[model samples]
Target: MPCCKTCTTALYITAPARCSPNGMKYLLPVRLLLLTSCLYRRLTSASTMAAMWPKVILFRDSITQYSFKDGGWGAVLADKLQRRCDVLNRGISGYNTKFGSIILPKIITKETASNVAMVTIFFGANDASLPEINPQQHVPVIKYKHYLQSMIDYLKAIEINEERIILIGPPPVDEKAWEVECIKKGSTLNRKLAVTGEYSKACCEVADTNNINCIDLWTSMQKVQNWSEFLADGLHLSKKGAAFLEETLTPIVLKKLEYVGLQFPYWADIDRDDPAKTIEAYNPYCPSQ
Candidate 1:
């Protein structure tokens, strides 16, 4: 059989299109056993099955939702992981910590939690909004941190563990530039740079308290001298900005994954002529007694 666009089809796997130097493009939710009918039948003798791919969940607001756009952070991770893991995104625009805490459990339940390799909690952009201007999205700085901690603990209850969780603070807002974008959208500026920093700081503090790794997007970007270039409309990440974030975050996630071996059997580990011959080799089921 011919190989996938990027990866060899030795193990009967499909290669994702839009392969970035950093992430995977057009990665759908696929189970390993369901990859092909031949392999599925060959593995039927095995009594247990593992998820085709482990998952790295991107849980956050709009910043995360747009991560798959234009070689963004999310897209880049998919590429880096190859078919080793699935980069699952659950981003909702205009959501703050207040609403996020309520919806967190619904998406990350015991079932989803079991196969997860890591989860990134990125929020606070909307929470950092000025209450007077963006009341619906505003979250008092103190409550914002509380909600973050609450989420960390919730994941722990399901055994996701502290080591697998990462917290990301809001990026620095460019007040003047964002104001111009707001006006173009027929609205006044609803956020301020200085005030947004508070929520970002709070996010870092929560990460500290929980002993979780944190990506301080606010401080890190501001150090760039011309940090405003990182934002597309003075708020959302532009292509350059997304690249910056992807570069900064890559090492952190990779380091955490050092302890986690790649998912499934590597191409070399598979039997080229009988792809399913080694299905039980890397299986999580039937661990040695």
Candidate 2:
């Protein structure tokens, strides 16, 4: 009779006749059915999101390779993106976009199997090193602009969608270091190389006009008081520096891929102002710090 009272209270919300001892057994089955339905919906939504995320490919130079004691930014980026989507690093040491244009297709063919969802192109440090192309040189700026335009055009022609391409401007070089090194080495032209700021701005302009995403790392690096934090040498990135870059750019990369209906894995928020604050100082190749 006590059991009947509790059952009657539960059944009052529904049908009292159904609260019979024999009928009470159906409650467990009903609860199980509801739980199964909820889980099924959750699984379906997760699968759909996973199918929507895009695969990314990165192209860069020595700064991305860590050939120097400080490793490249691309390596950090690859590690960050390792879980969410496929990140392929195709960076080579000492190569410019001219070489990039020649070899990118081959690399894509071999590495990506010709199926790239997005590509990030970073170059021009070496190209801007031309003797006659520096800001002070008499050479026309149009030539440099033309080279960039051609690279963009070639990417479009090779079946890479414009929407899927991002152009990252080079980071600032240490002008004083370059000047001192050039002087020590008696290389006048090195001192006369294109100003890092000017070259980066020019590249951004081209990317803007061509409807491609551009991140001006030159401007970003300028805000850091210690330039050495971003580049161990005047030209390449240190591990801490590369981590800063990856943190700043990863959000943008995820947004772009999302726009293309691609799902990306989790993104870690990195402080652009102090990426190296928590990281232990360690050489990329050497075990000794």
Candidate 3:
């Protein structure tokens, strides 16, 4: 939390000048000197003080992959976090935790980990697929738990600590509606509400074991009256459901952002007569300094 050295030094570069006649005569030269000095300091410390957008990675399955659709939950999040953070969609369709575990390292590497402010792990619906009907996407309950734990462990290894991670359990399924979709493909229902609840429970267990945050969508949606309206195809979220997701998740994301200020000064704050004075001294990295 300590301010960077470059910004700390920049703060003491000058004091406010008086508006006396002598001060006015030297104002232009003083402004140019201050600008030059500030530029030099910033350039010298570019490696550590360079501008970079902190990221919030949304890593999950089909539900997440389609979160940016018209009026989707991901789109809502992106809008809420416009300038403060970059919300990266790393969702892959039809992915179970097994495949997610295999590819997580490649998606989030050591190089990118430094700038990652947060990550949301959302999976389980696909893993809970009925093995007898859809063996390809179905994963055993026990292995699903293992895969979740492994992913959490791997993220911590790369320095994205548990504090920055959020586990989102699967939402409740509308078995009857999903069955209709299955019938269109010449198949019977391949998912059950009870089965998905098991995976959702397992997702929360991993989160609890690691002492990270969790969004138990499965339990939450089920508590609401007429929960079926929350889903589009018994599995994916409807527009109403996406709004609920935003309402639930936005508070948590905002809590994490309490200490993060806007990246740059407001346009109106730029001094018209001496723009360089404000521009050179403004330290987005260390607003307090």
Q: Clash pairs of candidate 3? A: none
By lDDT, rank the candidates, best first. 3, 1, 2
**Which residue pairs in candidate 1 have backbone atoms (N, alpha carbon, C) closer than 3 angstroms, thus clashing?**
22-76, 23-75, 23-76, 23-79, 24-78, 24-79, 32-52
lDDT of 2 by residue, 184-284 (tens): 76564352224656778888999889988888888887777886567666666767667777777778776654422213221243245654431222111
Q: Which of 1 and 3 is the better model by TM-score?
A: 3
On TM-score, the leading prediction is 3
Estimate the Cα RMSD of every predicted model relative to the unseen true structure: 12.9, 18.4, 11.5
lDDT comparing candidate 1 with the true structure: 0.76
* TM-score winner, 2 or 3: 3
lDDT of 3 by residue, 105-145 (tens): 99998656756778999999999999999999999999999
Per-prediction TM-score to the true structure, in the order listed: 0.79, 0.60, 0.81
Rank list by TM-score: 3, 1, 2
- Mind sharing the TM-score for model 1? 0.79
